[model samples]
Target: MTELGFTLKVFRQIGMMKPILPHKMLGAGLQLVKWGPGFPSGVNAAAKRFPRQLAIIDDAGELTWSEFAAQINQLTQALKDRGIEAGDSVALLCRNHRYMLIAMIAIMQAGGRVLLLNTMASRSQLGELAKRENASLVIVDQEFLEVAGDVDQDKVILAWADDDAPAGLPSVAAISADQPTKGHSKPARNGQVVIFTSGTTGLPKGARREEPADLKPLVSFFGAIPYRGNATIVLAAPLFHSWGLINFGFGLSLAPTYVLRRRFEPTRVIKDIEEQKADALVVVPLMMQRMVDADPEVIKKADVSSLKITASSGSALAGELANHYMDTFTDSVYNFYGATETGWVTIASPTDLREAPGTAGVPPFRTTVRILDAEGKEVPRGETGVIHVGNDMPFGGYTDGNTKAFSDGLMSTGDLGHFDENGRLFVSGRDDDMIISGGENVFPRELEDALIDHPDVADVVVTGIDDDKFGQVLAAYVVVKDGKSLTEDDIKTYAKEHVARFAVPGKTMFLDELPRNPTGKVMKRELPEFE
Candidate 1:
């Protein structure tokens, strides 16, 4: 699509948005750019529009938009008074709560770059990250203070603590106690928001984000999902992740009440959905699976009928998992496929899921997905190749100065995929994960998907191991459902019946559960090596 077409599409989507009144659309947009096209602007605008509306609901308590904005102002003044100025970087290590958001907004308003840290990382990793990122200050939660490393106590600010501020170290409370009315000025440049990669493949890398040149990512999202004005959402996904970050920004315009929890629990989420009458659920695939795996009696009693959308990203939505979620919730599921580097590429609605169980779906308006051969030529539809994507939002680069492979003006997503006859994109597996058994190429997803659908198979992960006879052989690690027993032969026989013989596992091992990261992506590197 041309620039004019994209602008038109954005205008059309804006008109269709429930929360944005047509008369106020231009003013709302101007407000987003008042500070910058990033976070603080949307929040500032929302506060002006709905000052008394419920802005945040967390385990600790509730906060109105007026209160959140006032806190943002006071904290921004405090940070500026504390000598934090333009180009200074602050590392934020806090969970989902009102304080975390307040600190983040104030940091941006104070002209400090934000490096979002992974909550699950070890202390050693956190120390390394802060030093490597050259952070001037570390705003950590009381629980994570030990992980702040050798940073001076004066440079450490506490957040989300129930007790009084620790001696010497400043809490957000103490810092903003004077409630200075200064520091409302925007910086010369919008400080970049840096989020670390999931590090499933290797040590985590920081990916620096560029403020998108256009609003297409937001417009395209609303075009795909039905988000209402003043709705309630349980944001269960971690805010540090790219998926959660993007969704949170997109929602500020709608003035939705965000119901957040520091930790995710299926029972607790179901309870929140009932008590708050939430309209949307933001999660990753693992959280969705947990919802499906909850006790049936608990689900029966909960009043979750208000949930209209279950948006998932940050990992693949397995065919079996999608089916089970739609079956249990009656078609509220939507899967968003994209990379932390590249913004969202495609979205699978309930209709798409019902039509093609495991599809990544087609690209939204003004986006492109193409399959390319090893030689960089576009392959015919239905032929497997590396997936390349182009969209309004392009990845800037890694903070380490490295970048992803680019082909024909699109960034390589590093996954192998092909388009179906119906034009739905199906991601097979990581291109590097393909197995060559006796010269026959196979994708482990095919076998994994087949096993996941089995009645007694709770979960499965398949990988290739070197073999003397076959160049490489498939190894299957499974989690068996409770009260069921199965042998290696039984799994192999089922694999043979469902998939090609060469795809069958050479051995099968059962684990009580699979190792996963906070976002619910399986940790393939942590799977025990099979002999």
Candidate 2:
């Protein structure tokens, strides 16, 4: 569709959904448009419009939009007083909590670049990242104090702690205690948020993103899902991820009540959903898998009836897992497919899951998905090729001066996928992970899917290894289900029944557990080598 048509469609969707919204909320959205595109602007608008409404609920307790805004402004002023000027880097290394959100808003509002650090990163990695980004300050939780690495004593701030506040550093609570409630003066430039890739394939690269020029993506999201003003959400996904940040950004205009937990405990998550009566859930695929794999009785007893949307991303949602989630919870699952660099490319609605089991669904209103060959030519629908995506929000190249190869104005997503006859997209594997055996090309996802179906197999990953006969053959690393046993032959027989001959694993290694990153992505490079 043309830009004019896309805008029209968005306006129409908003018109139809307007009656259900709070009075004058459309005026607030228009304010967002006029204020250009900055997170602080959207948040301040929400605070002014709905001052008394609940904005955040975390281990630190609840805060209304008015209180939320005040805390953000307080920290923003504090950063300014400490000589942290606009465009300076303020690295945030805390877990999911109200203070983390406050720090992000404050940094952006004060015009400081916000660097979201993965909490699981080692001290070496953290130190390297801080130096690479030229961080002016590092804010961390008390738990990470020992691992904060070398930084000026005055540049570090403790943002969250459960017990008594630590000495020698100004805690977030202390800084905000006597600070002003009003927002600080706007910065010279709208500081951007820097997100690092998950590093599943290699070393993580930092991806910088400026605020989008248009609100179409955000509007289109509301049209696609059931989010609205005052809706309550349990954000179980880590804030460091793209999916979690997207939800948080949406809340600026929609003013949804966010329920967050620092650590992910499957049972506690379910209990929070039940007690909070949350309307939606924000999560990664692995979190949903854990929820589905919970005790059937516990799942059955949980009051998930209030949940209208279950948004998942960050990894592939297996077909079986999607079906199981939809079956357990009234068809409320929505699987989103995108990368850290490209933003959201596709979303699988509940209906899409029912029709096409493992599909990532079609492109959203303004986005485009193309499957192209090595020569940059669009391939036939069913033929697997590299996935290229065009969207309103594209990453501004890597901070290390690395550029991704692009074709016809669309950026490569580094994924291999294909579109079916119904126009639904299916991710096969990474572009570099395809295996060739006996002159037949194979994708590891197919073999991995087949292996995961066995009752004894808990998780699995298939890698291509060198072999004299086929040049490159498949190797399987299997993690058996707890208290369950299966022989290598049993898995081989199951593979023979389910997939092509060339796709079957030549050798299988049983592991007690698969090594995964914090994001639940299997680090194949860290896997044990074959004997």
Report model 1's TM-score to 2 decimal places: 0.94
**Per the 3 Å backbone cut-off, how many clashing residue pairs does candidate 2 have?**
0
Pairs with steric clashes in candidate 1: none
- The TM-score measured for candidate 2 stands at 0.94
Off by over 4 Å in 1: 1-30, 164-166, 181-183, 200-203
Q: What are the per-residue Cα lDDT tens digits for candidate 1 across 1-531?
A: 775676455545443344545445565566676775667877877776777889999978898887888888999888888888887889888899888888888888777788888887667777777788888888988888887766766678988776654677788867887796433877766767889865654457998877776566676777677677777989999998988888788888677899999999999999999999998999999898888999899988888889988989988886579879878875788889998887877788989988889999889877888899999999999999999999877577888999999998989999999999999999999999998998999888999989988889888888888999998998999999999988999999899999999999988899999988888878888899875
Best by lDDT: 1
lDDT of 2 by residue, 392-479 (tens): 7757777898777899999898999999998999998888899778998888888887787787788888899989888888899998
Task: State TM-scores per candidate.
Answer: 0.94, 0.94
Report the poorest 10 consecutive residues by lDDT, candidate 2.
12-21
